[model samples]
Target: MAHTINDLVGTDIEQYLDQHEHKSMLRFITCGSVDDGKSTLIGRLLYDSKLVFSDHLSALEQDSKTVGTQGGALDFALLVDGLAAEREQGITIDVAYRFFSTERRKFIVADTPGHEQYTRNMVTGASTADAAVILIDARKGVLTQTRRHSYLVSLLGIRNIVVAVNKLDLVDYSPEVFDTIERDYREFAAGIGIEDFTCIPMSALRGDNITESSPSTPWYTGPSLIEHLETIEIADELSGRPFRLPVQWVNRPNLDFRGFAGQIAGGSVRPGDRIRILPSGLESTVDRIVTADGDLAEAVAGQSVTISLTDEVDVSRGDVLAAADEPPGSADQFECHLIWMSDQPMLAGRPYLIKLGTRTATATAATPKYKINVNTLEHTATRTLALNEIGVCNLNLDRQIPFDPYTASRDMGGFILIDRFTNATVAAGMLHFALRRADNVHWQAVEVNKRARARTKAQHPAVLWFTGLSGAGKSTIANLVEKRLHEQGFHTYLLDGDNVRHGLNKDLGFTDSDRVENIRRIAEVTRLMADAGLIVLASFISPFRAERQLARELLDDGEFIEIHVDAPLSVAESRDPKGLYAKARRGDLVHFTGIDSPYEPPESPELRLDTGGAESAATLADRVVEHLRTLGLLTPPPAG
Candidate 1:
């Protein structure tokens, strides 16, 4: 009997109830570059599973009436194309989630966007994925995007991979075509350290070799896509893994029940199991596991449940609960492989919002060790990263964070960076190793007293961060300020844009990641000077607000003063200090802030100086000196 909309809804509701009764489920993601047929493959998988209802079918049929390539035939891509823009673009822009069930297993599939620009979205979807399905368009074979997607999947440590080779019809279902692509990808996969790989061929549009056997490909012998998905053993892979559950919410209802609720990110948990809360490293035994349905004897990975611990220890959201036997290490510095996603480029020394598990922190890139050339898979000894570029970097967080190597565990290894002001996700990182372990072995402690050093040097160290448009008089005012401080018998160091480039930052270019590293190196140098009690005046077009804030955090609360050197675009262009504004106007620079890229001004600057309309460099310097006097850092010298 054909199931109607009403019957499907009733079955879904009953199944929802039944799911609460079960103790486990699996979550995975489908990822590839655009034109990989990810959406069509997912839609076909759901349709063949009989998970679609009459209403969904009718709606899709109705939606197809006004949309897509043809009339009458159902556009399966419409199933996952929930957004209007996605439909218009005919591409998956955001993460689309779908749920379905087979007789053997229940599954949640996150269909992630494939465009290189939306790599951050891919990270969000894959963050929770235990397995990943990477699609390859057989016609195009292994392209640059293919290698990039494979690198990211392996970097994120997705242990299981189903390499779905779509559009076999385009290649005449030639087994040789399939074998060549497979062998090429297999070699690429092995180089990146991915061991588990299953290659399958199918035409998502025609439904050939999707659910049932295809007689057209009698020469090819492999399980159908649906059959492989249904029978593949995932339980053993999860069972032996270490337990890690990041508490999302503390569910305390009416003062009667108090429990920590979160989805099990990895491993399993049972009643009376001993678990440790990370960052705190406090231990407790699980008292009971409760869901909305009832109590449970055990809860495994991917199950969302609330747990009560016997010893009421201090645990909250952002706290990770793990097996006491194998707790994640708390470290302040770690090495990572990052895919730069933002056009703004990652700034060195700039602070970014780091989200690991449920915890949020401020972190800075220590330095970029090297960038990998995607086409050749070779490490290019570069100092910075750009959009869609992959690099190995070291990060220094404000405090110690509990983390595991991505090779050891995906859940503990992956993290994302959010721009502080725009809140845009700028980068996705995979853990490689913690540098802190080696640091502790060869650690050195300086014996100089900071306060005494300031007194002896006759200056309080500071990082004067100047941000403005490209032609803004940031460098000009910074030079004058340094001159004034030098004459005032104060120990001062000036780090100007062009001067630093000629020396300390000579290797860096104007790309986003280069800018980030440029600011980072300058900030680190400023930090050292400040420790030695020298005022560090830094002048750069530090456009991003997040990067400025990161530089500020490296100093004392009042030590880092943001001086906004304000000037209208027209006025700055008239000055044309470096003739950069002309180049940016000429379309030579792709992401020049205030022209093509956005320059986020400081919302709450310590000082604002308009370098336009009769404001001289000396006057600006005097204004800065007055502000410093207000902070009790400087005074007039002997009333001369």
Candidate 2:
């Protein structure tokens, strides 16, 4: 194993410790199709490196006899697959990290799952990896998942790749077989922009060509996997990029000492260096680079240190300290590449919490520009991203944040999208660049604001949002409510679903993505009308709760009233006011609520009307008007 001193007890302990401490570290991941022997390969590495303890090795042997897949031989995979479920199924389910070292270098290998369903877990393991080991069964050649993993490795910027064609003994070590697989893999890898890679033929279970060259493959001429890993040059590119330190905390043990604490994400920083705070553009000089040991003259990327600023600037947890000369850009909107990981599809216009570096912001995504078919490498058009899907989309954040392109610095550009309701991580994304419009567009101030317009009209602006299924009497009741408001000398506007589709949302369909966009458009319009001091009545079958919540967030407190026109599917279908239900049942309509699609009813609406009851549409309208009157919305402005 790369000239390692295995006799730990015999050698001078001080000398060994010094040698080990000086070795550089490399992080890598193993991934491929299921049963490609990823765990076995890692277990072999640990075993050959003499890292496993004798007691642990004894347990592995006993377990191998009971549960091994190699005909009662020492199943090395048992060393890595520690979980009971993984052992029982003989598969890798989660990312298992293992540390082993040789005389040349220290290594941390991640044994990632190869199943298509656990692709997200694989991505997590590869995100920080410097290289990737893609195993392929000699019998199967190149499968779809092989291409998928390779593409992901390329996408994650793992330039160092080694295609380990395991199970070479299964093919009788034929030179022709090895040549064919190597040719096919090289062709596929070139298509995905993998310019250079090393291919090694080996059998992990038999321990051939692992730590040493195997005599079985006489025609094969290449170093073993461990030799390549130790010799590969994985340059420290982050130190050359622009300096960035996302303040994780404001370190203040006492009033006399105050410094910002965080790991330097990119480049180096020193005392007296000019720095700028992001999203604020405030400038200052670094006062001291403090660490646990003491103040330092300099610190580079990946080092955790606290630094005090020369000026008393307003810096907090989410602020980024950057080099004044080459600072990153800030933007509220961006185009990014997203890897959807959750079971629920990613819908356009629905807000999700985005965690980038040390900052968190509310983000809404537009429909995907395209989704990549990993197997074929084609960009196919799609409205939404499903589980394990990769797509390019535009995201609008609630506020500006500093970032670099992912290619420049991963820590400054990578982000994760979390579900606001469940707090589950739903997607991982990379910032390509901020959209130009995000910088160019600025909100123009007006002298006459919403409060002045409302006072002039002598009424409070409100949005009476009526939501329900089609043929549920929502439109009819909303029309009656607007007529009553007009009769009462109030300025009102009605935005009906069908009428808006004919003009405003003419190109939109009834798909989930389109529905989110539909509600987004209507919410913006509703906000504009309310700003004009007009009572806006918006009627639509807005199906998703997320979109409904978006509309609520756009308005001021108590300004948007959600009125659920409750009606059973059976009752609404029986009414059939527009014969839409019959068309849906006959398969003439697709994505129809209560038919092929789903409709998420509001959980706690401001008002609920039982449209299926004996109450007529006019009675429901009067109930709405009375509810508004009780809430003080109907009261005229007090005299000045």
Candidate 3:
């Protein structure tokens, strides 16, 4: 039988083990915007190092013949461009990973996409890379894409940078062209605080200064691309950083064994080392280090290892393990630098899911302090963030989360925002610092109950939850009821969906999880209002029955009046007061309640009004007011 590709890869791994004993591996990524010749550069490096197998070489030769390029000679770009679409389009759309080895070093290269549209994919590749090869065409020196890639590399905390100035052949192998680019890039790097940068001139197509010195450029005397990569000192890049290991999974094999398994995000860990679990702040000593092969005395950054603690502390997934002396602080609020990726702009007070390392939590964008101008690096005071824009914003987590400053540690500080409903990543954020400090003064509040406040106000304060489909006249009817109550000298306040949204609920959206948190926050606000001796009239779509029930739980029995504003879907569609139903019907909107989403109607309600009839808003308001009066919430008429 013949060995398959998987089997061949396994065999290669075994051969690699036999050939290289006690040798460490270095993983790096090639990153740049599209048309930067990243793939060609990587292909040239692999070919010059003689790492191409016979089968791969034969395939490349066959592909070159089919493409009709010069007598079946190797088109090096074909070596890494495995995707059919990539081959046809001549652009990388996803991260293509390749592994090869030379006698001096073993390497894993992540060839990241270059297009600005694929910035998320680039970040994904650079997140795990120790060094970055930023390709720049000698013809176009220091383009916008070049600056963007450089900023990303620094943001990701990739310490070592190899600026491979490709296509020297096109520049007539002139040292001046390379020197001008090098100087221009150095100025940008210095401004961004990137101190270590190595510039090398090379022609990836002609194999000039890739593995061998190019005779074309005698003035340039830097080491070849391959030589620089083989000897670059990356061991000290993450060596001095503080230890941080985010527990991704809890490993318990049997009754006697228990351990936490995750990749070492930064620094090193050894047996008998004391570590603290953040948020819980529990201290424990490392008992043993375990891997797939066997036990080990210690593990360094980038290694995947399971660690057992001696104290038997309650540590779980989403918890971070760090050095005891320099532990991460638990904070509920953070100020972060964010790069928005969604077309829908970021609205204030909208709740979203924040994922950091392996931990996920509900968070809200508290305020948009400023949006940074990417071109000038200037801060612009803005209220909202649009797609592909960078901004500095404050985030309030639902619960306390421990994190490090991005300047201090990338692994612990970087986070991504995921749309809770679509599960699409919408933003990449870097934590600057926690806005709220733990050592701040704490104040205790005086005791006050909701029922006593309602009695003192001389009225039965209740939340009038209006539930219905869009265009069901819920907000209009709630407004009328508030007017009638005010005329009758009853203390009442109306919380309309649009009105509250402009201020209190400004940050919310129509996403499912956002909807959930929206109702949760509105319910909390309504609960506070009812406790403050006022009847709160909340006019919202309040689509889900479960969420409405959650709101009801925050109040006493009979204090939450579920007002079902009943109207047929067809009638609501025809009304289309906001023209939103038409848009939803045309599939222009996603997650629109009553169109795509299931709007659970209220089973029972204190007041049910059929807005489809000839009844006016005044008549409905009168009916609700009469009911409140009968409940003794309103004073009787003096001379009726």
Candidate 3: which stretches are off by over 4 Å?
1-21, 67-73, 237-242, 252-258, 267-273, 286-300, 308-312, 436-471, 476-494, 497-524, 530-536, 541-640
Q: Candidate 2 has what TM-score?
A: 0.94
In order, what lDDT does every prediction score? Answer: 0.81, 0.92, 0.81
List model 2 lDDT by residue over 198-314, tens digit each: 999999988888988999997777999998898989798889887899999999899888899999999999999999999799999999999989999999999999999988999
lDDT of 3 by residue, 492-600 (tens): 8888888878988788778765676688789999988987878999988878665687688778777788888889999888999888988898999889988898787
Tell me the lDDT of model 2 at 351. 89
Best by lDDT: 2
Q: Ranking by lDDT, best first? A: 2, 3, 1
- Pairs that collide in candidate 2 are none
Model 2's lDDT to the true fold? Answer: 0.92
Q: Which rank order by TM-score, best down to worst?
A: 2, 1, 3
Question: How many steric overlaps does candidate 1 have?
Answer: 6
Candidate 1 residue lDDT tens string, 1-640: 1112444356687775565447245678888879788998889878877878899999988887777644658878899989999888889999999987665566789999888888778877877777888889999888777788778777776777889888898899999999999999888888888886889888887887787778878876888776676665664555578888888999888666788999887789999899999879999999999998999998998799999999878988888889999888788788898888888766676788899878888887755788997768798886557888889889878876778887666667888888877898889888888885645654467776566678776556677888898778888788888888888788888888778999988998876677777777777788888888878888888877666776787788788999999998888888886677788889976777778777778899999998876878789888998888788777322211
